[model samples]
Target: DQQVKQNSPSLSVQEGRISILNCDYTNSMFDYFLWYKKYPAEGPTFLISISSIKDKNEDGRFTVFLNKSAKHLSLHIVPSQPGDSAVYFCAASLRGGADGLTFGKGTHLIIQP
Candidate 1:
């Protein structure tokens, strides 16, 4: 069973357009959600995170929304830029626990200038 999944392996958008990435999870115990962006051959860096108690979180050009009832979450980047072209991975952790995280395969967002 896939604890976390990103159905789309890639996404492309113009430099000044909106870019959206989707992720799904099946584990009911996952309460902490995080999004990581990575460059080629590099480890993923933390971008944004949201707890199960909250529905939305934002930072600069990125926003994450969680729908606990639906077990889905998405990341949105406004005015996508060439710099935003990277792999985004969605991860989840057990609520209020410390056992690392489960990661999605990742979505490669390509920004066209």
Candidate 2:
């Protein structure tokens, strides 16, 4: 069974708008949450990360929020641009990322003009 799941296969957002990507996890052992963005013909690159102790973490136009009680997390991209269009993968790791991450199927984000 997949421990991590992205309910929406894809999302579309207007340029300069905010794009929110949701992810849910069934595993409570997860303590670290990471968001990765991938473009075609390229490997996934780390975007942002949040620890279980913190509810939110922000980096420039990217932000990650974690809800431990609900076992859910979300990535927010403000002012979405064409360059932001990519596949976003939500990953979780145990022991503060000492172990390997469990990645969700990923959600394709399309930024439209």
Candidate 3:
């Protein structure tokens, strides 16, 4: 079974609107959650992250919320701009120095004019 899951394949939002992406996981061992944004040909770059100890983390226009009890997490982008359109991947990893991360399928966000 896939440890991490992104139920929605895509989302459309108007410019200056809010964009929300959802993710779920089955592994409780995961303590660190991260969101990555990727463009057409470039690698995914880290956008935001939250630890299991905290319920939320925010950075500029991006925010990540974690619900450990439900094994769920979400990313929210407020006042989304055209440049914010990209594939967002939710990743989870155990707390360690070099452990690999498990990533969700990714949700493509489309911004309309």
Instruction: Point to the candidate with the largest lDDT.
Output: 2
Q: For candidate 2, lDDT tens digit of each residue in 7-100?
A: 9999999999999999999999899999999999999999999999999999999999888999999999998999998999999999999899
Q: At residue 81, give the lDDT of candidate 1.
A: 85
Candidate 2's TM-score reads 0.98
Off by over 4 Å in 1: none
Model 2 vs truth, CA RMSD: 0.6
Which has the higher lDDT value, candidate number 1 or candidate number 2? 2
Q: What tens-digit string does per-residue lDDT give for candidate 3 at 39-103?
A: 99999999998989999999999999999999999999999999999999999999731479999
What is the per-residue lDDT of model 1 for residues 39-108, given as tens digits with 9 covering 90 to 100? Answer: 9989899999999999999999999999999999999999798999999999999955367999999999
Error of 2 at 63 (Å): 0.8
lDDT of 2 at 96: 96
Worst 10 residues of 1 by lDDT: 93-102
- Give each model's whole-structure lDDT: 0.94, 0.95, 0.94
lDDT score of residue 14 within candidate 2: 99
* Cα RMSD for candidates in order: 1.0, 0.6, 1.0
Q: How accurate is candidate 3 locally (lDDT)?
A: 0.94
